[model samples]
Target: MHLRQFNKAGVEAFRRFLEACRENPKEPVPVDLLESHEHTVLTSKQIVVEPREFSSRRQAADYFQDLLSPIPPDAVRKDAGIWTWLSLFYFDQICPTGNGNRKVRNDYTYIYMPDESRYFYRHLLFIAWQVKQVAPECNRLFLDSSLVTLDKLTTEVFKRLYLTRIPCLFELLDRLYWDCSNNRPAKGIVSPHKISAGDLVHRFPTRIRQLEKTYDLQSLDADQLLEILGDEFRQRAATSQSQMELSMQ
Candidate 1:
């Protein structure tokens, strides 16, 4: 969708609905009714990049953060035909924006940064999970599970698995069936490998205080890191915005 004018209106309408939903969780959400009237706020991805004389790359990244905060959902709804509008590779980190706003006809969301792995936004992955719970009929689901056991995987891995059938996030999860070995090295096919050449498909909770000695990731807080990164991003956006103004002048 060209960020159609109607979509911009729709985005505002969705934001209003989000606010209302938070205010009244018990209220009946007439999704069909609200969506019918909502116009898409953005008409398209023709959003001009108004860059400023950014003193540093950090300033440029900050601008993107500011730009992302105001997007409408129609640009990213399952029904609408939009994808992340701009590149995520602005600086050291992969600052996320339209990562969540892009829409696919099937309602399955795929966000991969072909440039770098750090630019991958996990929250967009989370959104698909959330939509599954709230609107399973609206979308089918898949996820790439390769990240479950690795400290790091390259951007190629994220891309290779993103559109493949085996990439569905839940495809590989299974119960441990112990059998056939007296003293085992955890032998036998624990599970069939996901992510075959055929197809590409593919959270943690907050608040669980996992034991410090636990081998798996128990708990973590990315607040400080997020804040510091957020600050850098703001500067970037400001610079970009300034540059846009200057060009216009």
Candidate 2:
């Protein structure tokens, strides 16, 4: 289908639609919204989206990046309307029907709120697309996560405004948390128990920020970053490597 964006009225209508969905979580996507010219405006650059089941966020990001490549980055990067429309287009995958009903969340989760609000980055599709564009290498971190549920690792990392810009931080995370053997994140990276004391969700963000105050973190590579981490992180990294080695054997 050709790509279209919701106008102001369209966004308002979409919000109401979400509200209705919350009222009746099992309600199917309103097909009319897809074709309603009154609510949506055709973009100057028409791109087609062939919807399919995205196995992971990486696949979804890559699909969006390839499909939207022809359009100027600025046009789509900050375009709340297009992102919202895309979210609606892939509503099933992002917020799929489970058991008997869908679990719809806040409007910001489905709609792009570019107001620099804390929830601005929460939009499922847009954040995937954004991360793919800005930090393609870091895609490994989310390679196995569900497209529908936002995990703690994602929430904690992206919520920090500066974390995404520093490539080394992602590299460190990939080394410490990603399980290359199974092609998923290492287990318990976000666990809150004593076993996961230096976990990604709780310790990494604060430790990285502290590192920023003491070092020019932007200048450091992943190895250099690892060198400075506390013993907990290094121990975890060694364990991760050992696991990868064992899996390969």
Candidate 3:
């Protein structure tokens, strides 16, 4: 998905979007054209182009701050509504903002170009995951509808499963579904089923590293991969429990 420039026209459009949302909170936004950006943009530009050009860092920061200021107070009222709006309308606007601040280059960059993938801005996906905590039902709906949009915008592993031919991937989605249903904590080391989909996606690379020398996943079949993932999940659960126990000592 293309990053929305926090330019004059984009900012005004967002304001109107928020007004529309406040007026009809439950009614879904007309997102068909907006949502279709996934296939179109990813295919056209396989890289995150630097969308905003600033003459100086100060100008960019001021522009970003403008975008941040108009966040509707009522947007946060429905929990996931605000974040959904953010993900949909504003996430890309300030993605390349400075130091997580509006400034240009601070010591850190909040958003950057996608390296090997066609997506960028991972923190937004984490925010999407956070939506599950306060608004599970809302989060579910949002995830169901917007996951493709998110996948189009970021290099997310969960998105990879959407196109995966592996049968175990469906099992993984099933486990995540049940985890959300059960209201398990999304943070910390835990069973794969109990972890948030976004958290699991974030941690999977590391977990894969933990198993790299132990299993040649590339050589395994779908069922074998499923078993291996289960083994690792249980090991992580046990490790989490041990750490929790030690913390009490």
Candidate 4:
């Protein structure tokens, strides 16, 4: 299998690791250290959660900010502005860094921006995965040019499916957007909103949930999920195209 992102599965797996950390708050979270050269082969225990997973969002945010602090400075002089921005955004969202009013959670006075907090959490998870999967090269590349590397890696992963004639995630997502757009007819013309990557990413949560309901996605693996998604995307695309043609007539 090609390099798979630690997206959903990685998120879940990291949560499991966190759950393990939460079990014992007093103890220093155990990490099985690997030699500097052996970073590519990953295990669940690489990250050592210190003190404990905090109860409050503020505490959690602070802890995470400290944990991820090393990464941003590395990316500072490099072209990894997104990496730095995302990191700063998480901590900054906890408290408004500027003159603008900050929104706080209803339950907690200082607690604000759960969404950014979660985004940062996912980033940490990605880092944890990279530490194991990419090895020493991860530190060098992830800070400066990880997105480009990841995009290339994603393309490489898709290329593998070409032998089996399978549509990759990018193709599936494109078809999904095309299939979902409402066609408007006015003055003998049709118009469809231009779907972008952001649009697709925004719609994905709802669409993926819908797909889960349609199939037993919980039981399926990544490859199986891709297969089902591709089939459904193609079907939707075909149906939409037919509908558009009929509407024109």
Task: Give the winner by TM-score.
Answer: 2
Candidate 4 local Cα displacement, residue 34, angstroms: 21
Candidate number of the best lDDT: 2
User: What's the CA error at residue 146 for candidate 3, in Å?
Assistant: 10
Task: For each candidate, give its TM-score against the true structure.
Answer: 0.22, 0.90, 0.28, 0.23
Q: Candidate 4 clash total?
A: 2
- Evaluate model 3: give its TM-score: 0.28
Worst-scoring 10-residue span by lDDT in model 2: 189-198
Give per-residue lDDT, candidate 1, residue 163. 17
Candidate 1 residues 69-150, lDDT tens each?
Answer: 3454432333221222221111112221243332111111222222343443232322332233322231212222221111
Model 1 TM-score is 0.22
Report clashes for each candidate as comma-separated counts.
56, 0, 0, 2
Greater-lDDT candidate between 1 and 3: 3
Alpha carbon lDDT of residue 235, candidate 1? Answer: 41
lDDT of 3 by residue, 170-237 (tens): 33433332234224323432344445433455455555555557876556553565456556555544
- The positional error of residue 138 in candidate 3, measured at the CA in angstroms, is 16
CA-lDDT, candidates in order: 0.28, 0.81, 0.37, 0.33
lDDT of candidate model 3 versus the reference: 0.37
lDDT of 2 by residue, 1-249 (tens): 788998998888889889998899877787688769898988754687777899888888889899889888877778999899888888888888888788899889998988765987788988888777767785677645678877777877788878777767777787898776777887787776544656887788778889899898889898898889889889888877887888888
